[model samples]
Every structure is written in C-alpha cells, then in structure tokens.
Target: MSERPDISTPEHIRQLVDAFYGKVRVDPMLGGIFNGVIQDRWPEHLAKMYTFWGTVLIGEQSYQGAPFRPHKDLPVQQEHFDRWLVLFRSTVGGSFQGPVAELALTNAERMAAMFMERIGFYRDHPERFIQ
Candidate 1:
C-alpha cells in the first residue's frame, strides 16, 4: 500500500495563508479588491483562513464560517474571482516546495476553476447562487 505523505502541518498551513494574503495585499491585480476589506480585521481574517486551510489540508475542523455565502454578497465580478485564482496559485507557487505542495496547489486550482465557473454561470442566470 502507498503511504500517505506526512506533508502537512498547522504551521505550514499558517505559513501558506499568511504568505498568500501578504501577496494578495500587494498584488496590483488583486490588492484593490481586498484593500479596504481586510484593513483592520486582517488578523481575524487570517485566523479564519488558517483554520479553513488547516482543516482542508490536515483534517482539523477548526474552521467555522460561511465564506461563499458572504462572497455572494460582495461586489466581486467574474474577473475578480478569476484573478483570485491567479493570485492564489501564484501565492502557493511562491511559498511552497514539495510534492504535497504541488498536489495542494493543483487541487486548489481545480476547485477555484470549478467555483468560478459555477459562480459565473449562476451570475449569468441568477437562479443558482440563490438555490
């Protein structure tokens, strides 16, 4: 049997979230979108993100929030979502180096693509994100 790699840690997940937001805060492509949203609540937001990613990568159910539902209320467009994927991929690529990292980023990319596609379709239809 193939052994599952011991490739994830809470600290690693924290690093990824911190590094990703650090990049996002500076990226001209995505910075404006996150500019005012994360100013004072960056620490809390980061904590939530860490919990979310840690749960995803390490099976720790520390995350508690409905992120997508709030995102639906935001002023984000399809382009914003697409750019989020680009920035997220770039963030992961810049910070991690390993097979696990590769797998994680690949999965993240696929999920983001699927999310954007679905959201885009829903936005175009206005009948799905509601249901």
Candidate 2:
C-alpha cells in the first residue's frame, strides 16, 4: 500500500472530514445520535464539517459559530466521547501522518474532552448558559 499523505490542502481537509463522517454515519455506537440529529441533512452537515476542519486545521476563516452549543444538550456521555475519540483516532491513523495530521488527532481529543465537560456543566447548571 502507498504511504498516506499528510493533510496540507483544502481538498485534504475535505477528504478527512468526508471520510470521518462516512464512518460516523455507520458506526453503531455513534450512528444513532448523529443520524437522528442530522437525518436527511448529511450534505449540509458535511459541508459545515469541511469548513470547520478547514478552519481548525488550515487556518481558514470560514466557520464561525459556537461549535459546542448544538451539542450541549445531546444525549451523550463519557462512553459516547470515548467511541468518538476511538473512531477519530482510527480514522486519522488509517489516513495520514505528520504534524498537521497529528494536529487533527490532538484537536479531536481536546474537542471531545471539552465537549464532555461542557455537556456535564450544561446539564448541571442549565441556568448558567441557558435562559
């Protein structure tokens, strides 16, 4: 097999986002929540993901939104995040390597950890951030 290339371009971000979500959409542990939340809207979701990754991984000033707000109320917990990180690490490992690739993995792990904490905080203190 050929050596996977490091992520370096807009197309590469798209490839990573697309491939990652393709797996997410079918993953038994993650699919239900994602599919339920995003039913019939995969295209829009994937497009946002491309822009999000492009912004995060390549310094594109395209995505602008509270990336965690939409997920604060999702019925996810530690196990969900664990599965997500596993799939994400697996995807990154299967596809690419190098600083940028490592950045992607690192960022994913951070995002998962942050999201987990935020979700718990939101659940416990709904009055803090919610109306």
Candidate 3:
C-alpha cells in the first residue's frame, strides 16, 4: 500500500469531505441517517462541507452557518456518534497525515463530543451545558 498524502490545502479538505461523505452514503450504520437528512441534495451538502472544513482547517472564513443546528432532531445515540468517529478516523487516516490531519481528527473528536453533549448524552452536568 502507498502512503497517504498530507492534508494541507483547500483541495485536500475538499477531497477529504468528498471521500468521507461517499463512505457515509454507503455506510450501513450512518447511511440511513445521512441519506434521510441530505436526500437528493448531496451536491449542495458536499459544497457546504467543503466550505465548512476549509474554513475550519484553514482561516478561510468562507463558510457561514451553524454546524450543529441541523443535527438537533436526529435520533442519534452514543453508538452512532462512536461509529461516526470510527469512520471519520478511518477516512482521515487513510487519506492524509501531518499537523493538518491531526487537527482534523482533533476537531472531529471535539465535534462528536459536543454533538453528544448537545443532544443530551451528557446530561449529568446540565448547569455546565448551554441552553
């Protein structure tokens, strides 16, 4: 097997989003949820993700939207988030390396934790969480 390239540019971010979403689309665990929400708007969603990750990994500031709002009503569970992290880590590991890739993984893990907390998985400390 060949070594993965470093994720250091907007194009790399785009590639990561595209490849990751492609896997998500066919993933038995996540496919249903994503396909249900995204439906026929894969292009639009992909574009938004490209912009989102680009803005996140770089300082592009091209994306303009709330990242967590769309997932507010999903029937996600701990297993779902865990599975997402697994898939995300696999995708990133398979595609890239270096500080940018590390940052991507860190950000993904943080996002998963935040999403879980927001969706009531971590209700033990309700006072510390946002309303």
Strongest candidate by TM-score = 2
- For model 1, which pairs clash? none
- The number of clashing residue pairs in model 3 is 0
TM-score of every candidate:
0.75, 0.95, 0.88
Q: Any runs in candidate 2 off by more than 4 Å, and if so which?
A: none
Question: What is the lDDT for 129 in model 2?
Answer: 95
Q: What TM-score does prediction 1 earn?
A: 0.75
How well does candidate 2 match the true structure in TM-score terms?
Answer: 0.95
Instruction: Give one digit per residue, the lDDT tens place, for model 3 in 1-86.
Output: 78778787888888899889988999999999999988999999999998898898887799999888787668888899999888
In the predicted model 2, the residue pairs found to clash are none
Candidate 3 stretches with Cα past 4 Å from truth are: 1-3, 121-131
Error of 3 at 34 (Å): 0.7
lDDT against true structure, model 1:
0.73
Better of 2 and 3 by TM-score: 2
Q: Candidates sorted by lDDT, descending order? A: 2, 3, 1
Q: What are the lDDT scores of the predictions, listed in order?
A: 0.73, 0.89, 0.86
The clash count of every prediction, one per candidate, is 0, 0, 0
In model 1, the runs with Cα more than 4 Å from the true position are 1-7, 73-82
